[model samples]
Target: MDAAFAEYLDEFTRRDWETLDPDAVADPVRVAVVGLGWFAREWALPGIARSAYTEATVVTDVDAGAVEAVAAERDLTGVTPEELRSGAAADEYDAVYVATPNATHLEYVEAAAAQGKAVLCEKPLEVTPERARELVAACHDAGVPLMVGYRMQTDPAVRRLRDLLDAGVAGDVIHVHATMSQTMLGELGSDTDQWRLDPELSGGCAVMDLGVYPLNTTRFALREDPVRVSGRTRSEHEAFADVDEHASFRLEFPGDVDAFCTVSQNAQHASRLEVTGTDARLILDPAFYEREDRGFAVVRDGTRVDVDFEQVHQIEEEFAYFGHQLLAGEPFHADGEHALTDMRALDGVYESAETGRPVELGD
Candidate 1:
């Protein structure tokens, strides 16, 4: 970590917000939503509407019609993009969720921090490590929380996996293999020029979009940074010339554990992670950071222990947790610094792929 970021983390860790009483607080945590896109309309707004600790006070987007429609649908007052851009609406909210395209995260995050509002930004926090660090610094200097949308942190299955690993049940994790792919053709049909297809906006291709999940999952599971990464890419469509349609990478983490990840925008379906350890192997099906039925099978010497659940809604749980933290003035768990660490790992992978050589992460 950079010196400034390290200092910020130290300061954050030293503060305690759990002791604060939510009921004693005079006002609810006012929140504003930026970018009324698909994810915002479909997932984020519903989650926020259902959260009790925070109120959706305003919604903003470049398209007035879209913003107005979403605001009316969710029964929220609308804030125009002009108002947000000119800082007129900054003080109206205690926090802002930037659900814009990947490329716009930094600008919105910085703007929110400048306005003294905490921020929750969509994934791939920023396109580059420097940008991510700058956002982290801005939030730190403002003394406001900046959270990334890594919803897996709150998933029940993930929580269980973390507990099992920490308890030494998965004993000395040796290797991890994960794959995530989706049929993007229908989604991207004719709209090949969509922001997600644009390298400048999406950061990379399938790797940055879908691959970040497994990358983050592996990192979280091991609770360690990868030391090195090697990757290769393949493309089936011309629209993906600047991006990748499919890619696979190998990551070497500390303690000699290896992680193999594959992500694609052109595949038929998805596959989850399989973690191998000295004592057992854990298979997690229907992975990715959503609330879905996930099957966990523990195999020891060819004997299997199956674990299953009715699938928990991760977005709801994630927003609920964030609401509680916000209500209590608690620091964000998936804070900007943590997001920066994940972005650094992403940078290494991209660099490795471009240079055709394993990239080493610097401490």
Candidate 2:
């Protein structure tokens, strides 16, 4: 290889690739999980159990029976949501992990904030941007930390991509293409009456649920919020009558960076993201979904080089990062205000789709 080319490659590889070390905290954060739904049971609980910096000390839900069963099975204290809100077991946990439906997030988050507990609310912040603002204000008023669970931020590959972009390895980013889809009905199998189909509970179907992966992931990688959006959506099936089954949106960011994103709840399972810049293109195929393996590559001058990163339990990393921030008394990057940006941008997408025009997001 030529000397100049070798030096360039060396510089590219040496760029800061640092990622959060979740095990930095010596003390674990005691957590009370505020919902016992399928995601909480299947992913959140297991992830907390495996995390080095956090542990589930209490569990609660609206359903008393599910709370009892989960608490017993996990050897955790069981409490009703009302009891938790009333501070009956306030001393048991230092934080609350809320995994409830979209619209119900504010209630549990307010209760947690009232008790001065840090909150790790699942994504979208809340059903609407207005409600999300309320939730953020609640946490701010109580002077407690509030983090939205955007697990992609904790993934090492995604963080590495961010570092590379920040290092100018990709030059000036020109555009991004992202799409995420899943066969929701195929996976759930006739459970069409679930809360996901209810607009009130889920906010929206594909856009709010599946679409946020690309939208938030791009924001994290680019460190830029979208300034405007144009969107389109379709919901044909009876199950999706109240919400969108397919949605597409375009985002305009600062510095002329634009993104085209698509999401579907009725399509075959897939996730892919690509960012093209003047210098090279970065790709993360099979992107958003939690997986045991992730593919990453960089293409420059028609030469493709794949990069390997450590495989991690994304949810566990999220829990550990939350715990580390709490134990260290550090400000979180994905705090409530950060989440509010995405919430507002998402609201813009919906408004644009409904009105058949572009929506501008205000700071």
Number of the top-ranking candidate, with lDDT as the measure: 2
Clashing pairs in 1: none
Off by over 4 Å in 1: 1-28, 187-190, 289-291
What lDDT does model 1 reach?
0.77
Q: How accurate is candidate 2 locally (lDDT)?
A: 0.87
For model 2, state the Cα shift of residue 144 in Å.
Answer: 0.7
Model 1 RMSD to the real structure? 7.2
lDDT of 1 at 323: 74
Candidate 2's C-alpha runs over 4 A off are 1-26
Q: What's model 1's TM-score?
A: 0.89
